[model samples]
Target chain A: MILEGKKRLWAEYQKEIPDDNYFYVRSCIRQNFFPASEPTFLRILRDELKKDIFETPFHTTCSGIGYHSDIVPMETTMTVVARQFALMTEAGYENYAASCITSFGLYSEIIETWKHFPEVLAKVRKHLKQATGREFEIPQSLVHASDIVFKLRNEIAAKAKFKLVNKHTGKPLKVVEHIGCHYSKMFPSKGVGGAEYPYVLVGMIEVWGGEVVDYPERRHCCGYGFRHYLVKANRGYSVANTKKKFDSMEPYKPDMIITNCPGCPYFLDRWQYVIAEMEGKTYGGDGQGIPALTYEEVAGLVLGYNPWDLGLQVHQIAVEPLLDKIGIGYDPEAKYKGPNGEDLGKPEMPMSIRCC
Target chain B: MGKLYDMLVEDVRFQEGMKSCMNCGTCTAICPAAEFYRYDPRQVIDTVQTKDEEAIEDLLKSETIWYCGECMSCVTRCPRKNAVGLVIVALRSLSQKLGYFVESEKGRQQLALKRTIGAWILEHGYCVYPRKITVENHPEAGTIWKWEQDNLDLIHKRLGSNLDGEGNGGLRRIPQESLDELQRIFDVTGGSDFYNQIEEASKKKAEEMGLSLDEYVKFVYTTNNGLHGRDEE
Candidate 1:
């Protein structure tokens, strides 16, 4: 609980995330869960910031979920990841940026494993060669996409059309930022600020004019324990764990929650409705649940991107209220419209939680 | 050391995660699973460190090994720098490989994972595809999910996702060549064999429990042991 001690630890855990010219890999679930996030990230880096980030069609899933679920062997995950690195090498990029925290953690684990056991690395190399006839060198930089965002927060803040502060009250929004456990828990030094108090999201929140809330259970997992949520029966544990976090953060009365991980935002957003339905409890003021947003969505909003275009409408917990608080304007009719502006129809309202 | 302990050490995860356990209970104190389930990382590591073959076998067959969520929170706090979560990973792999995973309810969920995410990886090159997450399987995904599932292509297109299309973007169709290479990697490594082991073990258990394979899949997918709410502590 010592402030200076934590500051010292955070200082010690600062990572050297690369500035530009990186090879990116997409998440298996992030695309489906929060479809706009990866695109927003690319748009922010490529269009807005004018950085060089290349993505290849050849790269596939890193298979972290299967590995964590214990269904896929570590050797499979290692070889699959080696194939991804091979793709990056073929594309002539040395810095690797992963969109999913699980993939980031798995990549870090594999690299560390190879460092410890050269025989295993050699075996993975042999398998990759036999499978795809490809060879790869280790990426010079292995970073989560959020780390890139954190590294370039000031650049983003300079281009902002709005801030994380509420214009109505002239107060910084009380933002609860949740770092994915795998982002830093596996290797503290690999993340922007370390596990207990990861600064990847915090740096962005602070730089964009928001007050970070340090709730007691701020370090708790969002409960997307791969096997826990993947299996229908064991999902109680997942929701129960998420419910524990919501209960702890509720007293803080934050305006919104921001997460860097794919599952963190998905589960945090959806589990609010589940908790509301199960216990008739809501976290946000009035009968609504708190909005759980990905860091990219928040960035896109501050950078003046259209809310619907950022896919805020797809969120289970309506983000319109948070939008109103931030003084961002949006047409309610456009929430469910398609790309060419066709009406996509409205989602049915839930009994316990309010929806737009 | 017993035979089970010997086999456990063979996994690199075990070798890296298990160090000298002083039983400081820091890992148990911070373990979220221990708070809800009748599980303790301290005790689990102690049991493993005992190197008792019978105890290790019992650990594998029981629900204890399956309770860990593998969040790796324990790795952060352990004074001895142990990773009980990774140790659990090693244990679970050994459990599934040895056919002991079918003995417990939570462990039996491996077949469910294999069929869902595992199969999805090989089929679509993603763990959780948009089409695969249906209302029937994931009810808690809420009403918005139903709407999203109903308008999958339109919504993804609006969000600028390449969803089933080729090239780089959200949910884009992984190229057939890439998928073929992935399958080859799985075949070259032990992934296909591991999947087969899960399927065969679950099938044998299903027959022994007087259920068909499909019925067993449904049972494992939906059956709640009510362990979450039990006042086991």
Candidate 2:
């Protein structure tokens, strides 16, 4: 049966890409780190693709991080997820789209748990009904936003004003795609192309005209283990895990890194800054860290969105080097300006603190 | 008395994770946490297999269970299909259920986590609402967040968000009824009990240390925030 499941994971069980309408739930980490990415995704869907996406504040955190960290109990996690499903049921949507891979995995796990243990599902239903007088019909399809992006890769590429090729070199940019751990590792059968060699992000990179750099640590976790990154003493483990990826990917000298997972982009970007500080070595050409972007942000860039408006300027390591390579225009002085385009003035920095 | 070790062995996660153990070190070989810390998934499973009460208690009380990233790297590589990651989850759960979590540095941060992420779920529906992430505490959130804090309405408007307003597509303010419903679910599911357990234990620890409850919580939050295992010279 395990062999059969593994075979189906490779052949038959990958989630079919949804079309048209979706009920979107945001991720906690993604919104905080890459707030613009979600809004950008909505804009691309609504304006560019004409898809109907309903986002509500009533949909709460999936509590995947807390649950996995052992801070929140499994029962509590499932109950909270039931509340989210209840919200979606109340809103009259059957297709659920998650903005975070962890949430995606959590939802998938809960649904799978319900399939195997109906008693657990019954208890959740009883608790949810007692609490909110609400009940949910399981969503017809549950997908990560990256899955939607993967499904629409060619359409996005067709709409692109800029390709993933370097304007100076006239060559396709060497991009390393990092899939979040939960995206496939937790539920191997659920991911597009299964856990190993998942094509969800690769589909986007290839369709957008970028070379996907295959590395030794291509399947490694970003080490954003909610508690691993949260507790201060354990961050060395987080940094060490990232350092492993950098060491493996550094020799390839990839121009940019792209991620579908909300946590991966932040850690992959921020840890490079940390890695440079700790090891006195940088990953890419020159002493600068390689540019890392979420797949949604990458799509927004290709579709001719302004970098500042997409909040690309706020990244810890500068993205201008990649912007220059992509031939995307942005006035560096106006990077941190207010919405009305007022200059915030150059930020005061300590002797060694540099941000681009 | 039913031994705590037996209860751990009977946990659903432990049952689901462990099929048969061959004492293979494949899980440890692939673990990110094992490289940096004293964590070894193989050792954790092997220790549990011994079924010694004191050994299990020590496992619960020690920082080893807290070290697994829960990445499931062990799950993918285990030849015997034993999910060492799930074993860690069960041990951590047993530790928390028995209140042994308060013994370790990482374990004590449960209160901070409950207060922040746990509280956020009930209040805002989202674990992280943009307005709550301050530049002072999270400097890595960077200048863009600082700018967003100042010009939220304008930026959100441009980006097509309602900025927590009602009847808008982007992060609409959750209705009060929904928030109440969520609270009730938490109440029913023992979330409140879990939180109270952390508070009750921490309060006792605080009283022993001669600090007020509020003062102790603040101390733990800030102290644990910076306690990422760096040596203080």
Candidate 3:
């Protein structure tokens, strides 16, 4: 845990992410779990930052979930990813921005695999040609959507209506920035700040006035193992890994956990509730558990987007306390309203963990 | 080299993932699954390196190969530069192909994944869609998920999404033509065949255990092996 040693390592891992004009692909799970996250990212990129982030409806899942879960063959995964690249190429965009870390890691893996084995790449190209009659040139850059946000963090902070600070105490908010294991663990140079001490989320937190919590288990995975969580029988392993993380981070008393991966935030948030139900324990200050937020949600907060509009209400853990700490006001009544302002019924509360 | 070793080396992931194993225990030391389960990547790599068909067959049929979460954390810390996670991927693929996956509880769950996400990919072009995630299947998703599921159209609309709508947004309806291409890709690349193998193996296992296919799906979906989070080995 030498400070200078980690600093030197982080310096070497910086990536050259593009400035603008990107092709964005949505995550299968993130869009389902956190419906607003992808839209929030689009808004932040296209509207707030005024970047040219193009998206196409034809682009489909990378089959990464199936690939990592062992249901989809590697060749199938590669061809599907090639199809995505074809879509990107057809759309006339070169910078590939993926909303899911798994997809990012898979793309990195495929690119590296092709670099090592041209014959495999040729096979994938033939498969794509036979199936879709489409040819693709690999994009110049492959980046996670968070990398785009990290690249423009200072600009976002300049336009921010709020900072990641406890407005009442006038102190920086304590934040736990959890990097997805695939973000850099698979290919260290692909991520913004390498695998061990990824600085992508940390850059945003620091720019927006939050103190990053360097807990001991900081490098441990959030444990959204594709198979472990997808299968109900193996979910204990998923929750157990997350529990290990929560147990490690509990002593830090961080205000919230921020993550770049789709499953990380979902598992980190939902597993806290599951742990509370199973073990009667909570990690936050009171009966509440820590709010596990996506990096886009954290960016949305600092940009002064309404909490409900950011889909903060969709979380299993309550986020009202964190919003209150940041002095962001929201109407509790509108939390369950639909687009037409109709009353969408509120959810039944959990037993142990507090929910709004 | 043995027949099993020949098959293992055929996989590009195994080719790229397994460089050499000196058994320094770095991969095992950093493995999250190793900490929770009676699994060690170092030992698994060592066993595979031995190229012993019997031991490799034992690994394929046992629960050991299925325990990896595939976080690839081992790839980061391995001094040997070996991607043990990728080796696990290759092992699991071989296990499924040879019908040995159904012999273990965890590996047998591949059938559930095939029917759910694998089917969902060919059907909806998305692995996990909102409509399929119900409170009954995913109670951990909490009550808010129920509300969201109930008001899917409205919630997505409020969030500025184009759910099930045409052309460009979150949860947008993937065009039928694109789905046709995806289906063809799966057909040509043996993904459909791989899925069938899982179903066939699972069906035989279910029949041997005297349960219907639907009943087997329920059993695998809900049964926890209790192998994790235990105090004893």
Task: Highest TM-score: give the candidate number.
Answer: 1
Candidate 3 DockQ vs. native: 0.85
Q: If chain B of candidate 3 is superposed on the true chain B, what is its TM-score? A: 0.97
Name the better of 1 and 2 by DockQ: 1
Task: Give the DockQ ranking, best first.
Answer: 1, 3, 2
Across B170-203, the per-residue lDDT of candidate 1 in tens digits comes to 8888889989999999999989999999999999
Q: Each predicted model: what fraction of the native A–B Cα contacts (within 8 Å) does it retain? A: 0.94, 0.47, 0.89
The TM-score of predicted model 1 comes to: 0.98
Ranking by TM-score: 1, 3, 2
Each model's DockQ?
0.89, 0.48, 0.85
Interface RMSD of structure candidate 3 (Å): 0.9
Error of 2 at A16 (Å): 1.9
| Candidate number with greatest DockQ | 1
Every model's TM-score: 0.98, 0.91, 0.97
Cα interface RMSD of each candidate: 0.8, 2.8, 0.9
After superposing candidate 3, which stretches have Cα over 4 Å from the reference?
A: A1-11, B227-233
Candidate 1 error regions (>4 Å): A1-11, B228-233
Give the per-residue lDDT of model 3 (tens digit) for A1-356: 89999778667688999999999999998888888999888888888888898988899999999999999999999999999999999999999999999999999999999999999999999999999999999999999999999999999999999999999999999999988899999899899878765899999999999999998889998888888888877777789889988899888899998999998999999889889888889999879999999999999999999999999988989999999999999999998899989998888888887885
lDDT of each residue in A87-111, candidate 1, tens digit only: 8999999999999999999999999
How much is A119 displaced in model 1, in angstroms? 0.7
Weakest ten-residue segment in model 1 chain A by summed lDDT: A6-15
